[model samples]
Target: AKLVAATHNPGKVPEIAALLDGRFEIVTAGQLGLPEPEETESTFVGNALLKARHAADLSGLPALADDSGLSVKALDGAPGIYSARWAGPGKDFAMAMDKVAERIEATGTEDYAAWFTSALAVAWPNGPAVVVEGRVDGSLVFPGRGTRGFGYDPVFIPAGESLTFGEMEPTAKDAMSHRARAFAKLKAALFD
Candidate 1:
């Protein structure tokens, strides 16, 4: 089976591909030349469905999409849906990390409580769809570490671990990532 990953991030493509067990030939929206739809939805599940449905509608194939983000307890879950926006239009995460650091400093609390959330959606052109969410609680550290994962990976420290997701290998991170959890659910529901 062939399916389209309804995402623009090339980095995410392989992570998702690795989850598949040779049952599907995965291709990204970029490969299919499908335009990314505006994520006007207010929630992660809504956003995921929007993208998946768009791709499935256009490509006439099953489409998978995920809307994931970093939510900080101190910030009242800010940068939740706007996680990507925090990086600005150019995706300059350096500046975004600085902003988070500044916020933490101003809070004056040692607590860096945060979590990563992922909502995965799969849709078929005929309109059937499924969405599931997963989350990993942890904290954020200033002066971001590692250079592996993208976005907020450098600053996030998963619970019970010292190394940030950016420091862990893709397989290691995927083992406990929020996205991975959601993918597991998706697999059980549709694949297994």
Candidate 2:
């Protein structure tokens, strides 16, 4: 079956495609000239579903969408759904990292705890849709390290690990990322 990945972000395509390997012939929205839908929803699940539905409608095929963000307990879960925009249009994640670091410093509390949450939604052209969620608990670190993963990966140390996500290999990170967990659930729900 043809599956549409409702995202123009190239980074997301490979990870999700790897997770869904052999399940379907995955095609990104960019391949089909589908524009990203405005994410006006307040929650990850809401936005993911909206994008998935839009892609399905536009492509006339099953579509999968993901809305993910870094949520910091210290920041009251801020930068949660705004992870992408936090860096602005140029996709300057360094700026976002600096902003986060500054915010943590300003709080006067050194609690660098945070989590990355990913919500996956799958929609069919004429069927009920499903949403699944996953999270990787971690703490943020100053002076971000590594250059593997994108966004806030360099500062996020996954639970039970001292190294940041960006410090790990792509295969290793994929094994334990929030998106992987969510995709695992979505795959099971659909194929199992």
Candidate 3:
């Protein structure tokens, strides 16, 4: 079976594909030349569903979308849905990380508590959809870390780990990532 990953982000495709565990051949909305739908929804699930439905409707194939973000507890969950936007138009995560550090400094507190959230949605062409959410708690690390993962990976240290997601090996990080958790639920709900 062919499944459409309703994301233009090249980084997310491989991660999503790996989570799918070869059950389906994966193609991306970007590869299909499908335009990214505006994420007008206020919540992750809503945005994921919107993107999934858009791709499914346009491609006439089942589509999957994930709306994931980094939420800083000190910032009151700011940049949750706007995680990508924080990276600016060019998606410069380095700059985004710096901005996060600056914001935290302005907060005048050492509370670096944070979490990553992932909302996964799947939709069939002109049909119903399913959505699930997952989260992983952690804290922020200034100056960032390794260059392994994408988005806010460099600055996030999952609760029990020292290395940031960017420092951990792909398989290692995949084991406990927010997206992985969501994918686990998605598999149980739809694949298993």
Best by lDDT: 3
Name the candidate that leads on TM-score.
Answer: 3
Model 3 C-alpha lDDT per residue in residues 8-114, reported as the tens digit of each score: 88889889988898999998998899998899999999999999999999999999999999999888898899999999899898898888899989999999999
Give the residue spans of candidate 3 off by over 4 A.
none
lDDT string for model 1 (1-192, tens) is 898999998667777888765578898999999998999999999999999999999999999998989898888887888888899889988898888878878888788999999999999997899999989999898888999978999999999999999999999889999999999899989967
Candidate 1's TM-score: 0.96
Q: In candidate 3, which residue pairs get closer than 3 Å at backbone N, Cα or C atoms, i.e. clash?
A: none
Q: lDDT scores for all predictions?
A: 0.90, 0.91, 0.93
Between 1 and 3, whose lDDT is larger? 3
Q: Which candidate do you rate higher for TM-score, 1 or 3?
A: 3
- Name the runs in model 1 displaced over 4 angstroms: none
